[model samples]
Target: MADRDLRDCFLNTLHGKAVDKVPVLSVTQTGTVELMKKSGAAWPEAHFDAEKMADLALSAHTIAGLEAVRYPFCLTVLSEALGCRVNPGR
Candidate 1:
């Protein structure tokens, strides 16, 4: 049902019809620890979790009325995912 709905929505747009609100995703690095600390979220990696990260990212859109969210806070993920050797804390 979701797939069909999405297809219909896309088709309608191709035919020049309006859809619902635009969804946006934004990514951020740094400041997570500070934000988490202020929000009283313990655990060092709570800054790395999706839900918490999304909550923090959504604040930009909420406060500034800009459509955006946060993603890929780790600068190392690209290197790591590509199988490069990364010594942590280097």
Candidate 2:
């Protein structure tokens, strides 16, 4: 399969549809301190900025060789919005 087909493979597999091959994907946040530094996308700010978040998410694929990109680096947005003090620890 072509490299570009990986995206469809990932999506099709996610929806339980058939594909030429199963794409290796991380459904969870694949970011690391290494990836953050390499991609120039750190936390705190990336957690709030949509563009930064998307860039960081895409870095998983571009930098870490992951087949897919995930979003919302941390799980604190909803909690924070709900008035909970979300300490996004470094």
Candidate 3:
């Protein structure tokens, strides 16, 4: 095979477009107190406040190279929006 053809084939295999090799899965999730402790990140004082919560989340990705970052780390996000009080259970 030509070098160009081989390179394309390799790329396809890596992306699972071709079925030559079994693909390695890369997936992860958050929400572990131990992880925060290891990284020395402080939990938010008030999960009800959007800005403070965002800061706490950004610190995780910035410090540990997280794969993905999404909003409302606290479960109270929906409750807060619905005008319900969030205790945060800190």
lDDT of 2: 0.79
Query: What TM-score does candidate 1 reach?
Result: 0.40
- Model 1, CA-based lDDT: 0.52
Supply every candidate's count of residue pairs whose N, Cα or C atoms clash at under 3 angstroms.
3, 0, 0
Please, what is the whole-model Cα lDDT of each candidate in the order they appear?
Answer: 0.52, 0.79, 0.52
- Top candidate on TM-score is 2
Worst 10 residues of 1 by lDDT: 22-31
Give residue 84's error in model 1 in angstroms: 4.0
Estimate, for each residue in 1-90, the C-alpha lDDT of model 2 and write its tens digit.
Answer: 555787778778989998776677676667788888988888877887887888789898888778877787666767987999976765
Report the C-alpha displacement of residue 54, candidate 3, in angstroms.
Answer: 3.4
Residue pairs with clashing backbones, model 3: none
Candidate 3 lDDT score at position 56: 51
Off by over 4 Å in 2: 1-4, 15-20
Q: Write the per-residue lDDT of candidate 3 for residues 1-90, one digit (tens) a residue.
A: 443554565577767696443322223334346545654444664244556556556545554444335455655667888999776665
lDDT of 3 at 3: 39
Query: Candidates 1 and 2: which is better by TM-score?
Result: 2
What TM-score should be assigned to candidate 2? 0.71
TM-score for all predictions? 0.40, 0.71, 0.44
